[model samples]
Target: MQQFAGNSCSRQEMDELMQYVREAENDQLLHSALQQQWSSLQPEEPLYPVNWEGMYDTIVASPATENKVGLSPSPIPLIRRRWWAVAAILLVAAGGIWVWTKTPQQKTPPVIAAAKDIQPGSSGAVLTLADGSKVVLDSAANGNIATQANASITKRDGVISYGGKAPGVAANAPVGQPLMNTLTTPRGRQYKLVLPDGTTAWLNAASSIEYPVSFTGKERNVSVTGEVYFEVAAKSNAPFVVTTPQQQVTVLGTSFNMNAYTNESIARTTLLQGSVLVKIRNSQLKQSSYILEPGQQATGNAGGMLQVRDVHAEQFIAWTKGYFLFDHASVPDVMRQLERWYDIEVSYAGAVPQREFGGKLERNLPLSAVLKMLETSKVHCKVEGRHLTVLP
Candidate 1:
């Protein structure tokens, strides 16, 4: 039996044989071969045999065997042929580890060959006015654009801002025709804009913001689809409000971040300064509200349930500061952020093992480098042009 176990019985072949042994009926020839392999296993010290009684109990209780294999056979005489057969099978199964490691292993295929070339976020956006005019705001743009009512729209130092007062309009002007302004950044892009109402906003890559030309009436409101960092202007009389499909965040004056991307079901509102009230949509007449203090975050789901927790404000707002800081984040969450920034596709061949990764990666690093860092944790990744696939 030992002579028959030649080079032809590769690790792969042995694995298949062991799997077959688990399900197939026991025979004398197969049983003798397994016993020969098991007898060869010798530890440096006297190794006690495994507690098969306890192992058998666990196997019997397992859900997979509950409906199929049923309970273990009644304990038989120690010298019976059936008892020896079961012991040999268990011993052979335990020796599989030694065989696999002792044999030559196959070479794995390479995944990402080179790292992607990406730069730090910069000043970039595509602005569209109510008059159907498009303006690309970046470092190259010379000066301020046309003034709107009481504010002078200006671009300086790679940022867009509004100054001066409405020339002839009343202190409280009506919310004129809805004017849409969108701020977007590519993989290596970042931007900052000061709204007409003195509200300053910073945008991360692949993000956008839409707002009216001016705020009129009792409340100041804006709608966002992606991520944005807001340092809202203080106005006790006019509260600032941010609205998304899942919920709304209202504040008197505060600095916070709203991550309500369409692809993510959970809308997160992380407060950096002051306070804000998060209102979640529910079936009841009164929506659930959560008040957040500085260094707190309110995560609201589409189902209208909400949770408030403490978080590091700087880490939550790291994207606005030109970096992707992860503290034990999941692979899927990390990949989701990468997908939006790089504008690429991602898929997985098998289950992504649950791993907690902690590191601070510059946003400017190439996509390939990011994937390489992930591989350090035993996770493999393959990059085919713009598509990235994760494999176990």
Candidate 2:
């Protein structure tokens, strides 16, 4: 009797053996070959079997041929033993295929799910008056509140109204007094106010708007550090001026939006409804000025260089209308707007792709939904709590 060793049977050898068994027409010869292979197997050792249950069983159970030489009365046990061997062989083949085709599992970085649905222009900043007074204007509020000089300060229907009037003189009043006020908005808050000159201003989140009680000079100037939209009252004799870190905007009764956040290097002045003159610092001697007509924008860098270009007026003023409208804007630009509106932090984990996106976003939606929309256009974003990371 020839003995069969498990270790000596290579995959090629087993395949050849299976082919031989499949080709045998004599049942006695097939049974004798199988018994010899099985008897040689050590009791404590494992054996690999080929898969032949379906076709092999059908063939073994069929009527025998007339030329059967050493055929036995029963081949059921032989078929059963062969079935186990076939199963083992098939499992080994499957495992080899799996090993070759399987890919390594991907490792996903951790992400925070909070504030995943914050929309673009849903919230804004608030102004805390000098007397530790608070005024909520993101939504509707009640009746007339106070009067400042020539302005009637009223909080009716969720808006702060400042109707222009002449400054009243009180008996024995101090002359040339400066009544100071501070406008502050916490995270997830927003507010709007009408200045004494009938100019309308909207403040963004985590921002402040400081103004004097009255506009006394030939030029009315106000300073800001975050984002604000202004619709100046037309006063040709007294031009309205907006002062920021890099440049100043002078307008004669025009509407514009200014983004002058200290953390940002460039200050932007976008004209919406009128003309304005943009003057960069240190360029005063050269008299370098960019005159922006309606639907134009002037961008001033920290080095006092100004660039003027045409733009969509609606895109610039969309924040005041409770949305963010982007027309092929960059990733950093989009992130900056998100940080201000959501009052969150942003960091980049990988190289930021040089891609531009164009869309309009309502601030009332979830932050996750906003990021999902951005992802549809090759820009992937992940949120970790208040921190957002952009990936290329």
Candidate 3:
């Protein structure tokens, strides 16, 4: 307790302390004892900068407490015991050792003084009309932004939707080529879209999706890059098909997330609510496919066969829900996620650390706040300008 109060506890010690706290939270006697202790101690704000909410949530969602509870969308319950837990965190951070060390294993370079802090990403995207025109949704007004051949493009509360007939144009007059519109979310931003067929898509940062303004053919087809989550509107007559660089996913009105970033070695399609058939698009390999059910994920590479595995599907779509979840993720994997969302460059000082990270953090946290958490896990790094350097 004294070491924790002085912020001198190591990561393992902190883990043990957190375990004890979790036990107390569930035990009537320990709960009363902790509450009495809280009353005797004076509340003091942490002198060192700390992501209080992130720290609190991480502790409560630790594996010892709730194995996969962190992935759920349910809000954390508020109670009196939680207050004392937060107060204990503040006390820990108030100690001098919370300032961090210069050691290789726990180095935390002063980010604010050394460089500008990168703010978290927000809702933004670019809408490319068929005529080669573009509208920046971040700055565009919340109303009808453009008019296509058979649909009116409208932006409402940050969501771009295609609906309604163009003025002076008959809805059934489209006897020509279907107009296509592409929605792209640059790094440091994301956007949601409603397709002409009523299908909704949530595009992650550095992602793009192209589809027609109106569904004309027997199949509703759209090609994508990077990651996108879809809640396909039920259309029994027309199947919804998504084309990626490495695979094609065909669905009949279901919810799924596709991670097909060109930089990633493998493309993953996680099924959440409905069934999806994942087919390898690589020509060299014999055309093979796998059908994914809810709670299953299909993973394939450019030159490999599709493989199915059971997974906590919620983890794959956590970005759409505003959380970053790392389940036994490597250093490179975690850095890749940060690189896209924070719009920063990453370079290592030596061989990459072989450690695996597991936990959840809010996507809205600043870069420095995230780095601070990483340092606690003994993954040291330094930030300069828009670049992040992983130290040995």
Candidate 4:
């Protein structure tokens, strides 16, 4: 018998073992495997280092009726059900422990053995060069990728930086006929960039930023497609402008965040430092433009007035800091962030329930770990392959 405990296995080996667990109707085989795995990983020893006792106490006795493996049995003595429940719990815990420690190789398609249906995103993106060539930034060698005329674009320490004189920096020479370069983060990936003007941009998953290799004209301008947090370089003569689908934001030597996902109703611009002018073009905005102060957020587009409200700045830019900050965020809102981060899709079987979440969760946790947290809130769900279905 292959022992998964303390022994690593390839994805295919894990698949065979998991299939055995799922299909084995023989109680003897199941008991042998369960006992062997359990003896190796002492459940009584504690799952977490410091909080083992707390977790142990939390694992209350499951009702006899709770047969997690879909076992059919007649109404028997109370003692049998209680013991069955304990066995089921130990089997599950041991299996999860084994699966948690194993990871598939990079090129192989990963499978979720026990709990996590999806894994967290990492630093990756696609860099489209000026000459219509595409470079997979995640796999590319980290160094000087390609030079664009006078400026050089280099990848170092997981960030792409632009070096060399821009339109009005260092040498006063004209940076003629600027070539455009765009950095895009596909679903389940993210990246950072330092523009030619020394401004830094952190792009969220499913987001992109396109700009000239060199700062041009009186005002440095760039266009964005999704969410991006920016630390604009201070250029009094050449202000920085970020143009999105529904609105445009103008800033000078400041930091801010813009969330303009096409599926979202409102396009929001939150200012964390300095000042910014948000111009809304949607019909929802009665007033077209408003100046945002630090710690203020401008919400509403064409159909509404540029409404400015106070917000926790960190919550808006938490993704840049490697965390999901959910302060009374709705379930749909939470799932949308998860969808992009894990590169999965979510759907509801019926009318979506109204749910709000408030807390800070690490983005690095496996999908199962995160979902287990959600179960406490009564958000029952299941992940089949890459799709997550919300249960009533």
Better of 3 and 4 by lDDT: 3
TM values, all candidates: 0.65, 0.62, 0.76, 0.69
Query: In candidate 1, residue 237 scores what lDDT?
Result: 97
Q: After aligning candidate 4 to the native by TM-score, how far in Å is the CA of 40 from where it should be? A: 25
Q: Once model 2 is optimally superposed onto the true structure by TM-score, how far is the C-alpha of residue 284 displaced, in angstroms?
A: 4.9
Q: What is the C-alpha lDDT of each candidate?
A: 0.63, 0.60, 0.75, 0.71
Per-residue lDDT for 18 in model 2?
45
**Residue-wise lDDT of candidate 3 within 161-258, one digit each (tens)?**
88775432334646655777899999999999999888999999999999888886789999999999999999989999999988899999899999
Estimate, for each residue in 56-127, the C-alpha lDDT of model 1 and write its tens digit. Answer: 433333222221212234443444444345543343244310111222322564354444543234567777
Displacement of the residue 188 alpha carbon in candidate 1, Å? 4.7
Model 1: CA > 4 A from native: 1-121, 146-151, 167-180, 186-188, 282-287
lDDT of 2 by residue, 52-146 (tens): 45323322332221011111235435544554344333322222100111112224632433335544444433556545676555543566655
Better TM-score candidate (1, 2): 1
Best by TM-score: 3
> Which order, best to worst by lDDT?
3, 4, 1, 2
User: What's the ranking of the predictions by TM-score, best on top?
Assistant: 3, 4, 1, 2
Residue pairs whose backbone atoms clash in candidate 1: 116-366, 116-368, 122-190, 150-165, 150-166
Per-residue CA lDDT of model 4 for 1-392, tens digit only, reads: 24344234554564465455444364567677666756665645432232333222222221221232223433434534433443444534434311122222233332232444578999999989777898899998989988776788899989999888744233333445567889999999999999998999999999999999888788899999889999998989998999998788998899999998887878889999999999986654347798999999988755556778988787798899897866556778888999999999999866564555554567887788777655534455778888997765
Top candidate on lDDT is 3
Off by over 4 Å in 3: 1-115, 165-176, 283-287
